[model samples]
Target: MGRWGPRLITLGVVIALVYPTLGDPPRDGFPLSTYPMFAVDRGPVTRVTTAVGRDADSDRVLLSPHLLAGTDEPIMAVRTARTAVSDGRSAEWCREVADRVARGPARVDGVETIEVVTETHEAAATLTSDAPPVSVALHATCPVSRR
Candidate 1:
């Protein structure tokens, strides 16, 4: 009986672990879950609000999150960009990004203008290919001085 006690408890716990899966439309519970987030239908393409730098030679360069929001966190920069556009303050945000670029890495040295824009792209292609964006919605533009 003593030896069987632990085995029975183990068996019960295992059963409980998998019991949630037996439900027809599995509902989330104490630990394991079928949370609604998983059932969400997000598509392949996504529109992202961001900042871009235009070089003197007509080339567009994507700026980093640091230039956008003073942080390395991408989500924070996205929020900052989106908020600026939605609030009609994109010009101000664009200047901030331009300022950051002027003081940032050498790769942005030739950049003469900063643009706040929303770009749409296929998530998979963006990650795995050199494909161009599907669309770009420009919101604001500002100059970056050599200072």
Candidate 2:
């Protein structure tokens, strides 16, 4: 191999590594990542669809991803909730969550009802400062049947 052989190989490797960065964020996926942390502009506020439990006093307890979608993956749970709301099946989803709360562990101890909702919030603010959502869209609500 000549001096140019190593140089050519290095150039080829560099090009290969950088090629995926050229694609748009949504398309920059598959075997290679688009690195949405750096590429996607999440903006200031984000709308998240989720399930929550409310006791008789109206205190809200954010349900876990498992209770929401029967999976521990948050993204999957979010997708499940979003799909249910868009498909006009939020009541069914709410009932599903309510049943989970009634039968699952004691974290949701006094929860009396389940609600499927979408809330618009500034990133991390709703959690860090305990800030309320800028807006809330209630998709469905149902009672928790304690057996």
Q: TM-score: which candidate is best?
A: 2
lDDT of 2 by residue, 1-147 (tens): 999999999999888767888865445566666566565678989998999999889998888889899989999999999999999999988998888888888988889988888999986898799888899999898999998
Error of 1 at 58 (Å): 1.5
lDDT of 1 by residue, 13-131 (tens): 88888887779977778787556556767799988998999999969898888988999999899999999999999999998999899999998898899988999998789889967
* Lowest-sum lDDT 10-residue window in model 1: 32-41
Cα TM-score per model:
0.68, 0.73
Taken over the whole model, the C-alpha lDDT of each candidate is 0.88, 0.87
Candidate 1 TM-score over all chains jointly: 0.68
Model 2 spans > 4 angstroms off: 1-38
Q: After superposition, how far is residue 99 of candidate 1 from its true place, in Å?
A: 1.1
Error of 1 at 37 (Å): 7.9
